[model samples]
Target: MTVALMWEARAVAGRGEELLAWARDQGLSVRPLRRETFRAPGDRVLVITWWDAAYDAELPELPEPEGELVTRPVHRWRFESVEQGA
Candidate 1:
């Protein structure tokens, strides 16, 4: 089964671009199969990385951005792929 890691954060008032740039420059210890980034209406940025490891396996994670750039701590989630016709 495939697994994916989702990391999301809301930037401070007008720091959306700055936060997104920071996330873009960050690197992971374990390389992912693919990665995607998105921006939302409320200065929010979302990053999803596809991984080869299982959901329970140890994986690298993105660190939180500077305090001044974000309104709160980052939110993270892990999901495992489910068979469509099972």
Candidate 2:
């Protein structure tokens, strides 16, 4: 069964595009909910991404990202056993 993993990235700076692209290239199909800019004293932006099992991989030790990430938000939830197609 496929599952959906939802990530919430708040106040992210730099490397957003890179991460998104990398995940896709690795076979994770993501549906971006929103990438908005705001001014609230610190939390400036929010990025929500939904990814599923198509991107599954064997966990491995990897090096640091080619670019640095200023801020990051943790993934919030995992909805399991998702059904695909009609």
Candidate 3:
């Protein structure tokens, strides 16, 4: 099965660039099949990582950034791929 992990965070004030950079620099203990980073108008950064594992399997995820860098705690979610319609 394919699992995708999502990590999202909102940076403080005008530190979006710094937050994006920080997120991009983060490394996982075990590399995923694919990883991507995104940013939005609200200084929000989102990272998605795809892995080859079971839905309930233990997996590595991005850690929280320093308190001062963000306005609130990060949000995360996990989803397993479903069959595509033909």
Candidate 4:
């Protein structure tokens, strides 16, 4: 069996790029980790990423007037697609 992992995080006063960079750095050291996007605005969005270990993530730096991290519950959908990929 295979498992897909994704992380949804919300941070105030930060561009998605900053968060993406942080995630990307971690991905450099781990496999199957990537920055997947859901919904994004100026300072709020959903980040879908993979996990190779239990998440006890330390928050990264945000933009000006930074806000604390609000770690959302990570959710994933499990399914097998056709060879062509549905």
Task: Indicate which candidate wins on lDDT.
Answer: 3
Query: What lDDT tens digits, residue by residue, belong to model 3 across residues 5-86?
Result: 9999999989999999999999999999999999999899999999999999999999999769999999999999997576
Better of 3 and 4 by lDDT: 3
Q: TM-score of the candidate numbered 3?
A: 0.94
lDDT by residue for model 4 (1-86), tens: 22334444555455566654544444333444334655466544444544334344432222222244334433333322223434
Better of 2 and 3 by TM-score: 3
Clashing pairs in 1: none
Off by over 4 Å in 3: 84-86
Candidate 2 lDDT, 1-86, residue by residue in tens: 34444444333455556454443343223333322222333433222333334446322211223444426434344455546577
Task: Return the TM-score for candidate 4, rounded to 2 decimals.
Answer: 0.41
- In model 1, the runs with Cα more than 4 Å from the true position are 84-86
Count clashing pairs, candidate 1.
0
**Top candidate by TM-score:** 3
Off by over 4 Å in 2: 10-12, 28-67, 80-86
lDDT per residue for candidate 1 within 1-86, as digits (tens), equals 67889999999988899999999999998789999999998899999998888779888888988668999999999999876473
Q: Please give the ranking of all candidate structures by lDDT, highest first, separated by commas.
A: 3, 1, 4, 2
Overall local distance difference test of candidate 4: 0.42
Better of 2 and 4 by TM-score: 4
